[model samples]
Target chain A: MSDPYVKVRDLVTHYGTRQILNGVSVDVERGEIMVIMGGSGSGKSTLLRHMLGLERPTSGSIEILGREITTMSELDLYELSKKIGVAFQGGALFSSMTVGDNVMLPLQEHTKLPIDTMRIMMRMKLEVVDLAGFEGLMPSELSGGMVKRAAFARAVAMDPPLLFCDEPSAGLDPVVSRALDELILRLRDAMDMSIVVVTHELDSAFYIADRITVLDKGDILAIGTVEEVKNDSSERIQSLLNRKLREEEPDPDAYLARLTGTKL
Target chain B: MAADHETAGPARLVESLGRGTVRAVESFGYAASIFGETVKWILLGRRRGQAVRSGPIVSEMMDVGIEAIPIVTLLTFTIGVMLSIQGLDLLRPFGAEQQVGIGVALGVTREFAPLITGILVAGRSGSALAARIGFMTISEEVAALRVMGINPVRFLVAPALLAMLIMLPSLTVWADLVALIGGGLYISADLGMTMSAYVDQVLTTLEVDDVMHGIAKSAIFAVVITVIGVVEGSTVEGGAEGVGRATTSSVVKAISAIVLTDMFFVFAATR
Candidate 1:
């Protein structure tokens, strides 16, 4: 437990000429729920993308289970991916497949279990996500929150060592949001998996996070326990916690650069 | 101002030509890259591995080929009737109406059947491939597949390619048989000729090699149609509108490729 299960050192990422992550560094201890909190355009999603090895960083490194992901080959990365599960924000379930089939996909792909066993496992996972009888329905038939829960079911289907969830609480109602947050905490404890959740929902983040990392404009503003973050003295952290609207004066020449040929 | 305008006209023309050339080259390069990847997967890929499930392949085969039959039959039968009618009328002016049976047989088996099948199938299956793949891409299903360690080629494109290769030639055969029926109807009804006489003529005029020559072109057409569809579909940029655009362009590209490839086979096989 002393050693970090996932470690990032000086990660820099860029999209075209714009730097999306500016030397961000963080560590995720084993069996801990690390909630990445940031407002829109704060680069938390970019950081999550890096952690998942979905996008390559411009500089620095990520070590997942002591293996540097940036230098891993396709075959090696695939091997690494088997131990990691990701539940995308939009669910990203195959629209053509049934909810049951979607849940059974990773198992069917990775294991040679009998069809009956696979079906049983799928139903069990669905039961875990409170989608027990909804297996026959298509993704379109499910409500938005149900779809997210279904995604969560599929992500844990393989029992991966690490799990990543992107914006799980966004666009969900407060009741559904709280339910999902509780589900996340339950799953982490039950499965003993290290989880990383990226979201901007303050309530959900506070409820489930073992620790919180707040990001602002491509930089880490604060990193500590939930209580530490709530009581942190930094003005930026305080403003984020209070949800205060930014009040910066607009610059006119910058606006002209948008109208003119950017000659300013 | 007049002198500047005079120079700018030619300069604009040159710039436009340069841009057009670059765009054409880029498109060609993109097509070639996908073609190379497809060939690699077809030759070297494992059969239904962990990441590439067999269910989708079978489903795609039905989607891409099996469902395309009725339209193929109707269109080719119409073409055969038209060809027979025109052939007999044209030959009647020369007092060579007896040769109409021979002309229809050779034309349907050797060129028209395969050509018509290519066009129809390209429109049906090629557009479907593009639309399906483009929507999957926009929905991030493709990314999910990739993140799950699945190769898109094995999971999506290869099965379609394999299905097309098997189905296109089979469809061409069906087209040929249906076309002969159409021609037979025209021979007996309009020309007051015997069906036996037309069958005998066809049997002699159309050799095994002549039929094989056309069947070979259908295989080529299948490759072209499916490749264009997958390429255009997989590379879509925007949203729902992008899927629509990709589907349309894939159909157009498939048909154009079919026409050009058919011409090459026509000249080469005869020569």
Candidate 2:
């Protein structure tokens, strides 16, 4: 098989003495959506950071578009970043700048297009996210959903072939969340971009992900399609999927009293 | 058991020393990174001078010059008045109240005014720089800049350093004027010296070296303050607390470096 569009091999990441990702390995083909699902502290975000080259892995390597990102020089990595777009958690919009300025930043830095042309391109991207006239608004003026949409618009500003999104459905209502999921799907289909989404929302994951990787305690518990992950016999994955609560057995006296309907 | 205890005690001390050394080295590394980034951006600005000249430079002038003028003026005025008052009182005993003008003008124009103004600016603007950069560092904005194929230092520090270097001498000159006026007023009122007499004394006593020395020291001070602020701000970790600590430490370090450098200049110029 041809090399995957993005390949993560034995990725390990640490924060001080605590290991966030033990050994995460995954691959995504071109024009595919791969969702990394995990509970909090399951290393989903860490894995995504490694893939994006924002955080280097403590051990192992991440290859994006056939280049080892960890080993690449900063200049090379910056060039590589042009081919990739990332929608960070909370949208990560520059609070000081307006939406138009933020969206135009990458183009302004990397391209020599005329200002009027850049403005037209920026408006088009805003329109893609259904935020045509909101370009003049600051990040504070945007709702949570709008902020995410604006961030999405900025991420696709350059029409990158690869997109990474962290928790697209987070902090939004169900309707809005579904709308965002639909937008993600539309972007992938329209752009034919390989997408990697990090999230804990199973329903959203199932709706958007072509394949899913389940991380438990910094290790991948299962990797497959939604149906395959659901059917996997791994107890950890099963418990997480079912939302089973593990409660200790009650004391014998309490159990007996309850059964006999005695207050003593 | 005795041998084991002795070895453990020495081992712990060695480990502590090693840890401290590592932290210091890491700090130095962060400082170097910020410096390198600043230099890279400066070069970019030089290259892009033809294309994007006015916007970045104007923004920096607002940040470094317009924002800094009031504080520098206020401090210089206060220093001038206080120095004249103190000089009048001291010279009064010698029946040389006239010398108060010479003392205040020569001292302020030559040393105290610029040094004090530099320290104050370093504390104010330098700390703010550190805090701003530290906040950016923790927020991953620096990482974001890097990912965008933009060098963080060039994008952040270069403008700040360049703006300060450009504006500081002008600021020092303003401070000298304000201080001399303050000293003149003080000498006229407190020492009973005539305004004309005080002005004549100042004109006669003030040499070219005096003005040049103040401007030269201010340039050095600008470099020290800006570097410390940028370096400390970039090195910050651990979120808000880290930013706060870095700002405080940067101000202190900048002030200390200013004082030390001022002393060195004074010694060299006098010797």
Candidate 3:
């Protein structure tokens, strides 16, 4: 079998004295949509940062496309970063720039392509995110969904083989979230890119994840395909899934009342 | 709760002191690291035969130069009039009202213009630079730039340093001109000196060295303000309060550095 595109082994990270990721190990194959799902403060974001080479793991090793990122020089990292793209949770579009400028940033920095070609490529990327004509608009002018899409466009501008997104559906309506998930799947299949999404949303994770890595208290609880994770019968995963299911079920007040033998 | 708090007081105090010391050490380390990085980039840029890329430079020029022109001009004019008025008052006592022309011209061109402009820019633009970059650091935008393959110093500091290097001299020259004109008006009209006599006296008193001194001082002051602002801003921590503290400290440090450096320049020039 071919080696995984990204391999993280015994990764540990800390914020000062507080340990965040204890020893996370995961492998993501090429072209797969891997979801890192955990509750709040579960080190999911830290792991994502480690994977994207934003934060150095305190002890473990991260190899992206077989290069050890933790020890690489800054220039080498920069060169490697050109083949990878990231979409932050807040849609970190440069507030001072227009959507077009934001999308064209990587291309402008790394390529000497003619302006016309850059613009055409930028337009194509924007079109891929269903934002074909909103190129001139500033980030402040765009809606939350549009900002996410614009950020997505910028992430894919380099046509990187690996894409990392932190909380893709955060702060969006369910419909919009679903649309984003669909877009993620489309990008994966169409662009032939491997994607890693860090999220707490169960529905979003289940909807788009080809593989899921569940985290709890700085430890990986499970890492497997959707079916395997769902059917594993681990108490923590079951409880998490149950809690989500319980929250979604309608009107438990009547059931509680009947169980308690209380009269209205 | 009071009993428990009393029992924990010494331990808590020790812990707090320890944390504070650690933080101070960490901040010093960060500052050293940034200084080293700046030097490395300077070397790299020199080797590459290109100026370092800087976002802060463009933004600083827009904020400092374009936005500050009116206030700087106004202050220069006001200072000129005030200096002439004072010089006239003093000279009147000596029955030498005409000397006000020479006094105002010498003071404005050699000292007041550059000093006042430096202080103004240091207080206004320096604090703003500190606050903006500090907030950005807290927001992790600096880290974002790093991940995107752009050096923060190259992207943030180069522009600010370049802008101040260019703008401060320009501002000093403008301030010198405005101050002279305002002083000329005060001396000729208010103090009853003849326009041609005031003009000639001022012209005779003004030397090229006086202009050069002011511009040179302003340039040095600009470097001080930009360096302090960028350094403090880049070192900010703890979020909004940290940014606020950095801004305040940057202004204070820039002002102090400017004054001390100006005094050195004055001492050297006089010597």
**Best model number under TM-score:** 1
Instruction: Please say which candidate is ahead in lDDT: 2 or 3.
Output: 3
lDDT of 3 by residue, B10-52 (tens): 9899999999999867855765566566656666854533347
By DockQ thresholds, what CAPRI class is model 2? acceptable
List TM-score per model, in order: 0.92, 0.87, 0.86
Per-candidate clash tally: 0, 2, 3
User: Tens digits of per-residue lDDT for model 2 on A1-264?
Assistant: 778989998888898989988878899999999999999878888888788787777899888989999988876887888888888777877777899998998898788899999999999999988999999999889999999999899889889989999999998999999999999999999889889999999899999999999998899998899899989998889888887754578799999999999998
State interface RMSD in Å for all models.
2.3, 3.2, 2.4
Give the alpha carbon lDDT tens digit for every residue of B151-227 in model 1: 67667887788788888899999999999989889878887878887888889888899889889999999889888
lDDT of model 3, residue A43: 92
| TM-score, B chain alone, candidates in order | 0.93, 0.86, 0.83
RMSD over all Cα atoms, model 1: 2.7
Name the runs in model 1 displaced over 4 angstroms. Answer: A251-264, B1-20, B47-53
**Model 3 per-residue lDDT tens digits across residues A162-254:** 999989999999999999999999999999999999999999999999999999889999999999888978888887766653234566787
Query: Residue B120 error for model 2, in Å?
Result: 2.9
Q: What is the C-alpha RMSD of each candidate to the true structure, in Å?
A: 2.7, 5.7, 6.3
- Model 3 chain A: which ten-residue window has the lowest total lDDT? A242-251
Clashing pairs in 2: B37-B153, B41-B154
User: What does the TM-score come to for chain B in model 3?
Assistant: 0.83
Identify the candidate with maximal lDDT: 1
